[model samples]
Target: MSTGKFIVIEGMEGAGKSSAIAVIESILNKQGIAYINTREPGGTPLAEALRDMVKSVEHQEKLTVETELLLMYASRSQLLANKILPALAAGKWVIGDRHDLSSRAYQGGGRGFEQSIMDTISDITLKGFRPDITLYLDIDPHIGLSRAKARGNLDRIELEQMDFFIRVHNKYRELAAQDKAIITIDAAQTMVQVHQDIEKVVIEFIAATDLD
Candidate 1:
């Protein structure tokens, strides 16, 4: 079977990934593309369980940085092997809300872990698999946190210090700049503008890939 394309949307909290994904899904639907949607650290059943544990603030003791990193990858491994790869093998494009880039930003950047560790883990689990296109929503941390606050209670990771998210934002920019496939969108724009930017990228990708 022909492998399908992988598209991942990445961003800090309240960067409007959900809205961006909605636009992507609408575009793909209109294009009549077969696709599957998945989210990192919580796609498959096992991965969802891991997400709950990782995001839960009820843990009696602190969740170590190493533990957080391992759980994220464990969930990713399950999602990739069980859902993502198979969907692609069947010639279905995959839309991921978050992916390995989240680990690079959140764990490696936010937690101050070494990039070598992330590289080693990714090489072992993913064997260098990566998204064909990554749409990164860039937003200021202050604005993002304010939006997140309006939404509701914050998760464990969402409750992190401003400095952590600042690092994550910087890391996202750094990584996006290094990769031609990664497109950065100004997420601080109005919802209408954000959707417009997303549509433009999706349309361009569809045209370039020539997907039927």
Candidate 2:
């Protein structure tokens, strides 16, 4: 039996991930490919709850960095075991808004956790499971945050200092540079251009994987 592919759309807030997702879905639909859409720190019941807890700004005391990192992994573990793996085993592709890379960028970079610690936790949590293709929409933090703010109220993570997002952005570049599966798209470009780039990547991936 053929194993299904996993495609992850990763980037900072307002990096045009939603638009990219739409483009990918549209292409897959036209090609009659089957897929399930999901997001990390989310997707399962438990993961959604974790998402809320992590994003909520209602905590009386500041949430500890360790707690935040652990919750992210906990949510990811649930999503992977209860949703992602099963869908792939059933031969259905998965389209994810975010994935393990988020943790590496946000927790390891933005939050200043040691790379070794993040690697150990990730290795234990995911057992080396990774996306077959990652479309990383690269954008400057200032531009991304400006876009994010225009959309709605900022979440806890979104409310972080500009420097935090800079670190996150840098980490994304670092990780993408090292990983062949990740394709970096310049999100600072116009929407039309961004979508064009995304479609080009998706088409190539589909052809290579024979997903069509």
Candidate 3:
């Protein structure tokens, strides 16, 4: 049997990543593909606990940017090692909501952390595993932030200032430019259009790689 594909959907807050993941899940189901849908910062049991800590608004005083970054990676590392890899090895497609690029953009770019520190942390946490393909949903920070605000209570990261999200969006663009496996998609489009674009990309990728 062929190895399962590792696909990731990444974006800033309220960029409709969750919606896109659902759409993709439906597509895979229709195609009769065995797949697992998951999210970073919280996938495995241990990781979910860490996610609570990371997302807690009550920890506003206690969480430093560096601490936040580390905790995110800790959760991610646990998820990848315990759940993501095992599923992939068993020939199941693994679709992730967010991945390492989020750290690079949020901590390294938005928080103004040193690139060396980000690189070191990423190297240790990720080891060598990289996503087979990443769909970067690019959206205006202003619009994204408004959507996030409407979604309800803000978490530690979601409560960050608009400027921070702008920086993160810029960084995402930079990373997308550097990585061939990353595809940038304009997310300002209507949800239906965005879903169509994502479906087209996934279908094209499968065809090109002969995944079917």
Candidate 4:
């Protein structure tokens, strides 16, 4: 049996990942493809719990950098083993809200962890497994944060200062540049245009590959 593809949508807070996912889903539906949607630091029950622990502002004690980084990987491990791998084995495409890239950008860049640390942990957890494609919605942090603020109360990560997001934004671009599997989309455009760019990418991928 053929294995299904994995598509990851990555970006800073309010970089229009949700909108991009919607566009991808629409394209998949039109093509009659099967896929399961997931979110990083989330997806499985255990992962969701980890997500809450990491993101919930209700926590009295602040988690250290190492602790937070490990938790993020822990959540990712659960999602991969319990959801992603199984779905792919069954020939179902996986559409993810965020994935391993988030850690590299957020913890490695935003938190200023060493690249070696990030690579070591990622290798341990993922063992070289990666998304077939990563759609990175490139957007200015100021703009993205403004949009995020309009949504509601910000999560712990979302509440980070401007410089933190700038680092994340830069790291995302740096990684995307090195990885050919990643596709960058101009997310600063109107939501309609963002969706169109996402659809164009998805359509091209579907047309070029015969996963079925």
Candidate 5:
């Protein structure tokens, strides 16, 4: 049987990833595709635990940047090994809420980690696996943070200062431009318009994948 395709939704907080995923799910349902959805740093049991540790604002001691990066990859390894690979092998498409691209943007770009270090860690964790397509919802850091704050409590990362998020935003844009598999969507638009743009890209991807 052919391996199932992997599609990922990527963006900084408040970029409307949940809404975009809903649109993809609707399209996949209409196409009668069998699929599963997963999220980064929290997909499986161990990963979920790690996710909590990383996100919990209650940590009396700050989580070091290096520890945070490793924790992210550790969770990814579990999810990939115990869930994602098996699902794809079973020919079930996977809709991912976030993936390695998050690391590339957040840790590599936002944290200012060297590309070589990022490359080394990525190779160790992912080997060569990657999503077939990633829809990146792009928005200004100021705007995105406002939206996130309005939704209520922010995570440890979300609680980061505005300047930190600005760095993340720049990294996201930089990496998205260089990668063909990554499709950028202007998320500052009205929800109606953002959803429309996402729907159009997903439909096109589905059509192309079906042909392939």
Candidate 6:
């Protein structure tokens, strides 16, 4: 059997990543694909603890950008080592709700960390694991924040101001521009339309890769 595909959905807060993941899971189920749906910063027990530290609204000790970056990677390392790679080796598609892009966008762009620093952490922590395809849901920061607010219970990252999110969005665009493996989708469209677009992309990617 072929190696499993690693697909990730990424975006700023409240860009409907969770919804998109659900849609993707449904499609994968319909296709009888063995897949694992997971999220970064919390995929493993240790990683989940790290996620709480990173996202706790009350942990307002003002972490340095580099420190934040390191914590993110720490969680990622645990997740990849304990959950992601094993599933992939077992021929299960790993659909991640978020991935390394979140680090590049949030810590690198939003926090104004150097690209070299971000790259170093990613390289060291991930070794060579890269997503087969990354689906970026593009939405206006303001709109996304509004959606997030409607959902209530803002985490530390979600509580960040609009300016921070603008930076994050810009970084996402930059990363998408630089990488052929990343696909950006207009997320302002209705949920049905967004799901249709995502489905089309998944079909094309699977066909191009010749995955069973």
Count of residue pairs whose backbone atoms collide, per candidate: 0, 0, 0, 0, 0, 0
* Cα lDDT tens digits for candidate 2, 61-127: 8989999999999999999999999999888889999999999999999999999999899999999
lDDT of 5 at 94: 97
In angstroms, the error of model 6 at 3 is: 1.6
Q: Name the regions of candidate 1 deviating beyond 4 angstroms.
A: 210-212
Question: Which candidate would rank higher by lDDT, 1 or 2?
Answer: 2
Worst 10 residues of 5 by lDDT: 203-212
What is the C-alpha lDDT profile of model 4 across 125-155, one tens digit per residue? 9999999999999999999999999999999
Question: For candidate 6, which ten residues in a row score worst on lDDT?
Answer: 59-68
Backbone clash pairs for candidate 1 read none
Evaluate model 2: give its lDDT. Answer: 0.94
Q: Compared with the true structure, what per-residue lDDT tens digits does model 5 show for residues 78-137?
A: 999999999999988999999998998898878889889999999999998999999999
| Candidate 4 segments whose C-alpha is farther than 4 A from its true place | none
| Shift of residue 115 alpha carbon in model 3, Å | 2.1
Ranking by lDDT: 2, 1, 4, 5, 3, 6
Worst 10 residues of 4 by lDDT: 203-212
What's the true lDDT of residue 28 in model 2?
90
How would you encode candidate 3's per-residue C-alpha lDDT over 81-182 as one tens digit per residue? Answer: 988989988889999999999998998889998888988988998887899999999999999999999999988888888889989999999989999999
Better of 5 and 6 by TM-score: 5
- Residue 77 alpha-carbon offset, candidate 6, angstroms: 0.4
The sequence of per-residue lDDT tens digits that candidate 6 reaches over residues 136-191 is 99999999999999998999888888899999999999999999999999999999
Which model, 2 or 5, shows the larger lDDT? Answer: 2
Model 6: per-residue Cα lDDT at residue 207: 70
Worst 10 residues of 1 by lDDT: 203-212
Candidate number with greatest lDDT: 2
